[model samples]
Target chain A: MTANTPPKALAFDVFGTVVDWRTSIAALVGQVLSAVGRPDIDAFAFTDDWRMRYLIGMRDFGQTGRGFVKLDILHREMLDALLVDMQLDLAEADRHTLVMGWHRLEPWPDSVEGLNRLKRRFPLVTCSNGHIALLVNMARHAGLPWDAILGAEVAQAYKPAPAAYQRTAQALDIAPGELCLVAAHHGDLFAARAAGLQTAFIHRPLEYGGAPAPDLQFQQPWDYEAGSLTELAERMGC
Target chain B: MTANTPPKALAFDVFGTVVDWRTSIAALVGQVLSAVGRPDIDAFAFTDDWRMRYLIGMRDFGQTGRGFVKLDILHREMLDALLVDMQLDLAEADRHTLVMGWHRLEPWPDSVEGLNRLKRRFPLVTCSNGHIALLVNMARHAGLPWDAILGAEVAQAYKPAPAAYQRTAQALDIAPGELCLVAAHHGDLFAARAAGLQTAFIHRPLEYGGAPAPDLQFQQPWDYEAGSLTELAERMGC
Candidate 1:
């Protein structure tokens, strides 16, 4: 008898795995900073700094155990603080418009094509730390046709927590074994695997600024590792 | 000086309002009953019996106040219980497939076109008691392009609770005034208004079966009322 392993759903890690967040944010920050007469400012650094506060804001809520703040709000909070610290003065309306840059992120080259192919074979969705609104807006802007959008904001527990992954399967009414986590980050796949989900590692070597690094190599322990989502879909026999 | 109204995000009620749940479930029930040689079975009674348990399941979860459960899971529980009471026997695989019918409900005739028009100018999303995954799957199945999906599952509280609408706005990072609850049910809009949201009542008369008595007739102090989403979209200038 063939022990067929069927994944009821495939959940993706969005930031670097699906969309090039580093490059996308850098472009947006560069445009905004240049417009505001700060041409020499390090846009990449500015983006990274803004994102660093993301975890901190979530941790504040996690510690208080009172409220769950969506990532878009947390991003805005961080952006406001960072702008003040960087000694920049911008109008309220302009700042609000700039904050929406996250909604306009460009998907990677293979994202749309690969996702469409995979969608024919499995239920494809996002399981990311980004809030539902952010993911939805990003999908709309990028023209990504996702079956569903799942996020930590819905679970109120960020990744690396089993609750996040387990809750996704529970919400979909699929068993953990019937779900696969597709991510570029080893840590994310490790967390998903620990939660009983199958893992598919996608290599996004340039995720941390297109610099050469050791961790980008395909990890063998993963059930599947591919150079890109195109290869991943092909390997999945989509 | 311009007297500016607050930005409004349209929060829709799913289930019977957007989709003809009665017809969908009745068809499926009839099909299953006929296939099982129980041709004379009362499908309407079965559908209602299955639906009544929905609120009971939510109330039970609320009563326990422990971990949360999604609507799909709750529906499965109810379906299994009802199937037994109806003296029906279904295979495990068939039972799973039948439970997934919620994910495949068709939209009302005006749903897609109306939502598309409205979405051109407004942030449109679901504010249903169903879980995020349930709503998302339904959207994909029905070709309903929602800008975002919000639900009582997000707040761990069901409709009629103020927290449901309040949490939806918080998740979107929009003020309560910016979220207008668009629903057929008076009680849902009443709860939304109580929680400080704008209210638009759409007439979905056949939600509970037969010709629905016009519940919110004669304007009723709402921001707007329309016969269908097409009319609603025109009123919103979309």
Candidate 2:
């Protein structure tokens, strides 16, 4: 597929591509730590650690198809385990609030406008690993205009699984070739490409804070590549 | 549930309730008949007959639970059977266009504005028998502002099945009691209520044209009842 001929729909990876989960999580963790009288705790490290645990969880799910659980549940479970490891005492309400923070993650600066622009031409949907509730809440909170929510919850399978990409395209009633999976991660794009869907890579240099960034350079050929979602929209003639 | 306490999300019945499917289908069929040199065909009767076949298809699926097929496929099958019965000849492209008419159904006059208003307060989603793609396309065509698309495809079960309502509520991460199912059809509302969801009835007297309308009077107690979706929104204080 050529960049000149855009796909009918663009399915986005929400966590790092559309929403700045690292910064949002760190900010939320900072507030929680301060509220719990532990302002000295490194919120960024805590956020990174939590995210690492989530990655491990996804990896385990990919390796072992032991049924499916919503990402919100997994997030809460990981949060509880992290609290135990950190030896922090939090009230049930506070724990619930912190665990629900995933639902309140802020979108990247370019996300709302870029998506709105893209939406004028093509249907925009989230093809993330997040649960449907999480995607709905986050879109509502962040003012992201998604035509539909199609993701791990809708597919009953996590990302990197061919079913995820295939099911999303099926839900849209489009051939996999007519759907583009937009993400900042190469692994996601690679998997989407392998699933016979077009891929777009948007550079998110600050996705991991100061940690070594994923290779921003296009490791594999994709249908479209842009420095940011705004650039992506511009390239797509939105 | 009381009228004063609104649900977090409103799951709407799209076909006859939110969209004027009968009129839209008749109009499309009229165009197709004219194009095919069969303008003498009664488009309204054809529409009704096609709808009856669709209901029969749903009934068969409900009784069999053999698996699930998207409504688009079912509509195509029913259309083909009807064409055979009528001895009408149409080009493959015309047949495809006629089948695709389901995606172009017009919303009721109050649908767009009322949904937009309700959307400001509660997430508005479609819990229709239509597939996700059908709902998405219809929303886009008619400018219905749906937050997400959840339906028989998502649940892998047709409406009136407990699993449909239950799965929609589960997908929203809300208890069935906290998800309101708004429809003009009593059976759908009753099924939703049986599944523990709140119910709202909007009177759509013209849904079936000159054919006698379904008993408009609320046979059983419901959480909310209104003359139109606009009135429903007003009653809900949206």
Please tell me which predicted candidate would have the highest TM-score against the true structure: 2
Compute the TM-score of each model's chain A versus the native chain A and list the values. 0.88, 0.94
Candidate lDDT scores, in order, read 0.78, 0.87
Clashes of each: 0, 0
Considering every candidate listed, which one attains the maximal lDDT?
A: 2
Model 1: per-residue Cα lDDT at residue A50: 76
Scanning candidate 1 chain A in windows of ten residues, the lowest lDDT window is: A211-220
Q: Taking the tens digit of each residue's C-alpha lDDT, what string does model 2 give over A1-238? A: 3554569999999999999998888888899889989999999999988888987788568777576788877888888899899888788887788778999999888888999999988988899999888888998899998999998888989988999999999999899999999998888888898999999998888889856654435267778999888889999999
TM-score of chain B of each: 0.88, 0.94
- Model 1: per-residue Cα lDDT over A41-160, one tens digit each: 998988877766664554355565655456666677788899899888777775776678877788889989999899878878788988877887788788777776775877678876
Residue A167 miss distance in model 1 (angstroms): 2.0
Off by over 4 Å in 2: A1-5, A214-218, B1-4, B214-218
Tens digits of per-residue lDDT, candidate 1, B85-153, equal 978887777667667788789888998899999877777778888877677678877988777667777
